[model samples]
Target: MKIISAGLPRSGSTLVMQMLKILYSDFPLQKVHGYIEPKEGQIRICTYRHPFAAAVSNARIYNDLSDEHLKNSAIYIRKMAKAVDLYTEDGVTLMLRYEDFYLNRKLIVSSLVERYGTKFSDMLVEKALEYSSIERNLERQRVYSDFAHWDSETHIHGGHISEYKGDPTSWRNYVSSSQIQILVSILNPVRLRWGY
Candidate 1:
């Protein structure tokens, strides 16, 4: 089967893709960084995160928290929100939240397997989780610190796992109160929809 892994940038979409790659070793998979119309005969695995945190991460990666950066992040979040709504309404997409994946990977993996109508042994599930664990990814980041270096297998690049505190609200530390207000105001719809 063909699989499309779609999500906003820096929202753990790569992690989801990596896990899926491990679970469905024979399936052809592609990662779409933003919204895309689902294709015929494709399994869509969509992941998303709190808009605030996602914006913060985007800004950090670009080292720009300016108004322009925030505005762009808002735009990306809006597009991702639209994708989420589209996939949810389609009723076939397996929507996974970044927070849930981080907190309970086994549950998320199990859900993915169940949604795909496949069964994986507990050992395989654990292997996928371990392979995609933050520590291993951080090591990859360290080895590939150059911006040009991208790991083909994991689709990870240098500095991909920046300051990941595993707390959704950690975005607050990177931006000012006014910036936070800006994100909240612009992304209120997403927050309400995703329960961020």
Candidate 2:
């Protein structure tokens, strides 16, 4: 089946693309940032991260992240969430959580294959998990300095998903308490809905 992967920044969109590349070596998977019009029978797998963490990553990457920036980010995130939810309700897309994929790669693959009829194998899934491991991807960056520029022209620190000090809440270190409160206030609905 045809597939397109889209997500907000730092939501493991590249990782999802890498996993799909390994899991369905023959299938063409498009890695994109925003929505693309899928052809018939095409399935879009949209990835999402906790909004607070995403906002923190944005701040780290872009470095501006003023109050206005966060407000705009919240607006954009709400629009993205609405689109993902609407598409999912219509069966045109599947929403995958970055945290879930990182913690339960096999289960995510199995569910996709079973529920969405995507052709995939357990062995391939295992291999993809290993191939997409943080260490391997980081090594890739080391060997090919160009790999540092994946989704953006500027260098992004902490490109590795596992670089968060072994804690999901490590974003707290980057953002201030007031910023966190603002992010939480803006994204509370989505946080509650997504159980983050």
Candidate 3:
């Protein structure tokens, strides 16, 4: 199986990937390339890149893809979902929801099985089950750190998207305009699909 942690930056994708790495320390990964090549019979994944790589590399639509541009994020999300489905038909790219994923580990596994076919082995399923239980609280850190700092420090922001007291406004300064456009273009559809 190939589970892509597809959430946008500052939305816990890296944090989630870091936690998952603890469980699969033996796996060969490309953090820069955004890919993971696991052991034989083991699962592999490319968190942000594989899906957005195409868009990021050759983005004809350089706009923010904000509600102003995309107009209907839902429509775009469905389209992206269908595209991802093509790569995931045989389970090469499983869409792991970051929201409910943190809520219930076992239930998430059940859902994954149902969506990807329940034929996965108990061991692999167990690994998936273990994914949500890891101990990592970068969000909490981001929240705590946000208030303590001001000035130029805020420009180097990271970790959580809504850490600025649920104020996404801080993201405006944290992310570069160009990068913002890239992410909005790639992730708004996802946010729309996810109803974010």
Write down the TM-score of every candidate: 0.89, 0.77, 0.38
List the candidate numbers ranked by TM-score, top first.
1, 2, 3
RMSD from true fold, candidate 2: 3.8
lDDT of 1 by residue, 1-196 (tens): 6989888777788888888888878889899875567678787888888988888787776677797798788777776677777776787788888888777778677786688777888888888888888888887878775545889989878767767545666777788888888888888888888886
Q: Highest TM-score, which number? A: 1
Shift of residue 59 alpha carbon in model 3, Å: 18
The list of candidate 3 runs beyond 4 A from truth reads 1-12, 31-42, 45-86, 105-136, 139-161, 164-196
Per-model CA lDDT versus the true structure: 0.79, 0.67, 0.40
Q: What is the lDDT of residue 181 in candidate 1?
A: 84
Off by over 4 Å in 1: 36-41, 146-148
Q: Between prediction 2 and prediction 3, which has the larger lDDT?
A: 2
